[model samples]
Target: MLLAHPALLADRVREYETLSALDADEGGAAARRRMDDIAYSLCVATGTADVDAAVVAARHRLPGARVHDDSLITAMHRLRR
Candidate 1:
């Protein structure tokens, strides 16, 4: 769903590859955090409530995928650039 969602701005394939690498390394907190940030960005871009709902639904489907709440986009957006 996230990949299919039109608001996703990052490269899905590259993100997935990075995530896979992080998982293999087993101690990639920074990489994992980036993945969370990307997920949150996609969710926020889709809709504010989407992240939570999608994570729940995705967990049910994949069962092993790690999803986290990285809801920083709103705050990031609010920052005066």
Candidate 2:
């Protein structure tokens, strides 16, 4: 499987989070569409079906990610060693 570059994943994650935090009255349809797009992108990048899982996966793949962190990806990486 081809993994997404950490920098790109980080940017997507930040964009998703920022859009998610917007007020319902803010940004209108454009923001919603962008959020959906980001969610889909993140899912594809992480090879996961769920956005929450995708976010975790992206974070785990980021540079300086703690090997000892308790995330599922961290455990998986450990098992692969």
Candidate 3:
């Protein structure tokens, strides 16, 4: 979606990143995690329809990145209403 048209979601990540920066701690680790969450959500949302490709792309984006166990990804995937 947005990838096909980068501009569509261009500022979104930056906006979220800025929001994350506000919560900077321990030299911005919290902010980094927030950025990761933002990216993960985008990829996951895109991947839900194409799980394989999306997961691969997301993983590639963070090859050695270790996501926190208690991150928001699980909660985002769980909410159903």
Full-model lDDT for every candidate: 0.51, 0.88, 0.50
lDDT of 3 by residue, 1-81 (tens): 444233323444455546645654334676767666665665654554443454444443443435555546778778842
Cα lDDT over the full model 1: 0.51
- Full-model lDDT, candidate 2: 0.88
In what order do the candidates fall by lDDT, top score first?
2, 1, 3
Top candidate (TM-score): 2
Candidate 2 Cα outliers beyond 4 Å, as residue runs: 23-27, 70-81
Q: Residues 1-81, candidate 1: write the lDDT tens digits.
A: 233332233354345456756673365677767777766654554444654554444333342344554457656878856
Clashing pairs counted in every model:
0, 0, 0
Measured against the true structure, the TM-scores of the candidates, in listed sequence, are 0.36, 0.76, 0.30
Question: What lDDT score is found at residue 45 in candidate 3?
Answer: 46
User: Ten residues in a row with the worst lDDT in model 1?
Assistant: 1-10
Error of 2 at 58 (Å): 0.3
